[model samples]
Target: MRDSAAGVLLGLACGDALGRPVEFQQTASIQRRHGRVTEMLANGAHGQPAGTITDDTKMALCIAQSLVESGSFDPDDVAGRFVEWYQSGPFDIGILTSTILRRLRNGDAWDEAGIDEWKHLPEGSNAGNGSVMRCAPYGIAFAGEPDALVTASRVSSAITHADPRCQWGCVILNATLAGLLAGEKQPLTSALELAADAPAELRTACEAVLSIMEGSESATDLELANSGYVVTTLQAGLYHGLTAESVEDAIVEAVMLGGDTDTIAAVAGAVAGARFGASELPDRWLRAIDETAEIRELGQQLDTMEISFPESIVEKLSSGQFDLQA
Candidate 1:
């Protein structure tokens, strides 16, 4: 459990740093400049400093902190944390998210803040990967219980993202975390199957992602899976999860896939970290990350939290009670 949590934190930081340099680059541009971007660089395509994490890592840590504080999923408290983090100001925040969070901080009711339509913005226009990037903690916090993982994921995601795709992405990520914590080694196909019995909304999304995964080849899988929301980003991460042989490979593949690279890598990193543990993380990468102590502390706190599910559930999952549906 400690290793899993540590892997989660370390994986998050590593992905953040790795993708920070190339967050907005196109596939061709990235290939031209970095040639597959296998190693972490000090600056991205736009020359952003190395180790710079975008809103994805910032929001993810906020979720982790909230989990440590509450010992369970609490959307209200998580929302409050999001508001505070935004007020404190970070280097990067999606425009839609920034607008919504600002309204939340300025006394708008959490439910109503983001619902109003802006000038050119549609009422429910968000299809970003914001939700999936920060969703790793939900999986780690509610490790074994399928129902709880789904519930927490939905609630956590709905704070900023309301699209079905976003919600589905959270479900897939949570299930991947569950499978890894349970010590399963099968590809994401088995993980999605374990989660197929989730609520109807999430089940459909999982099935969509599964179909995409089944027909995709290694080179074009990332292109097939959009990364704008929970579903697509989760699908992209799962593709990497299926093909990657190491934590490093998983993150690199996620980032190289292009389009929301940081977030895809972040989600993939969390899953790979859980499966491989902190020991599997490359030592040089670990040493180069910023905020190593804070990340480590957060992981330790999460590790100390009591497991919320029953022992039977944990054992059933750990023993591979579910069959692979793919």
Candidate 2:
């Protein structure tokens, strides 16, 4: 369990670092400049170091630490942690999320933070990959209970993103985590089919992903997948589910995919790490991440908190037989 959580955190950070350099660049541009971006780079738009992580990894650790500390999903605490985290200014955060979190800090009710209405911002204001990026922890924390996973994902995402697409993206990630933790090796198509009964908005996004992935022959076939919350999250989960032969392979494949690379890698790494555990992660790669001890401590806390769930559930989760529908 400790190793699994460590793998999840380390995978997320490594992916973020690997993807940071080519974040918004086209694949051709990235290939032209960096030649595959297998190693971490720094000082792009943010002027950070080689192994520095972005909001994707930062927010994921925040969520993991919050859940580990509280032992359950607490939106208010999560919001508080997010605000405090941003105030410290670790990475680039999205405008909508920053605005919503600021409002929450100023005493806005959780629901009033523009959770249910698209009109909360402009027409296209709601659907970034921010929510989906940090959502992997929810999947890890609620590995056995689909309802709890979906509900906690909704709660965590609603603090910033209100679009059904964003929320549903979280659901897919959580479902992926559940399946991965359960040791189920269903194809991406079959796994998504299990979520066919999800909300209409989510189903639509999943259908779009299905179309892109159905006939894919090469890695580039995934380029058709969008970087937005809906498409990117599903693509990340699918790629993580399909391509990963090891933890390092998962992180590398996710980072190399290009669009929304950091978030995609982070989300994919989370699921893959959970499925494979820390021992499967390369020692050199794990040693390369920034703040390894902090992330590992957070992982320990998360593991300790698993005691809140029933013992049988925890055992099944550790054994990779936890039921997703449960």
Candidate 3:
């Protein structure tokens, strides 16, 4: 239970790296080539090392570090860190995230950066799983305060993603993970009910998640969409995570769904991690993630964060007075 933070973070990285090699392959190909992909293997999508994680874990690490440093949701700091990471050249990055960050680099303010970008992109491409994939750190840091969790999740998402589904995607995920960390017996349900203020689209996707968990809708029947679309990814990821019997099986099943495999598995891994503590996560999977030690350390730091929210930051966030230089 106490290891929920480390479990969620490390679980995400493990899932990302495990699925890295076979990201775009169909379920049949995955089953035929490697039934139950349990170990980290090299030469898949990006042709990196066996334990190499993609941008999902890397961006999460950035968010975790910013939260620890600021002791709150510092949107500016988070934005700057993302810009820095983008400049450093990550191997894998979502299209929306890259577009928004590039605009940020070109002098768009943190608060204003994503608005225009989101406006130009059409529906299917606008709401991507980018924000949701890296938002677990906010859940860990704000595990005690649901209101603050929602605010942080939504605001930080504007650093790159501004769509309601994208923004509420983070809200739903972080809220659920926060509840799990707080030891809610029915964490996901608690989160959904608590997030009643979230957009209806988010609720619809979340209802799909429950349907999967209730065993009434088969994964195949539920139309497990593994695309980068936020709603589909959320549905499929949570379906696999909440429905599977074990952590390994959950991650494997999500990745086996094919497209957007790493991100889907990352999201599923976080949900499964909350359900089963860090102790339940396989040592082999942990060892396989190259940043395992960093993930554990960062998760611990976030878990123990003594929240000291000042009125000034809240005012700035609420009034839309975010400082890009902060």
Specify the highest-lDDT model's number: 3
Candidate 3: tens digits of C-alpha lDDT, residues 258-324: 8888999999999888878777888988877767888888888898868544567678766767532
Q: Report RMSD for candidate 3.
A: 2.8
**Deviation of model 2 at 67, angstroms:** 1.4
lDDT of each: 0.70, 0.68, 0.83
Residue 206 Cα positional deviation in candidate 3, in Å, after optimal superposition: 1.3
Give the TM-score of each candidate: 0.82, 0.82, 0.93
TM-score of 1: 0.82
Which scores greater on TM-score, model 2 or model 3? 3
List candidate 3 stretches off by more than 4 Å. Answer: 212-220, 320-326
Off by over 4 Å in 1: 45-47, 114-124, 187-229, 307-326
lDDT of 1 by residue, 127-197 (tens): 57777788887777777767777766765665666555566667777777777777765535655675564
Per TM-score, the best of the predicted structures is 3
What's the true lDDT of residue 318 in model 2? 52
Clashing pairs in 3: none
State, as a TM-score between 0 and 1, how close model 3 is to the true structure: 0.93
Each model's total of backbone clashes: 6, 1, 0
- Where model 2 places Cα greater than 4 Å from the true spot, the runs are 187-201, 204-223, 307-326
Model 2, CA-based lDDT:
0.68
lDDT of 1: 0.70
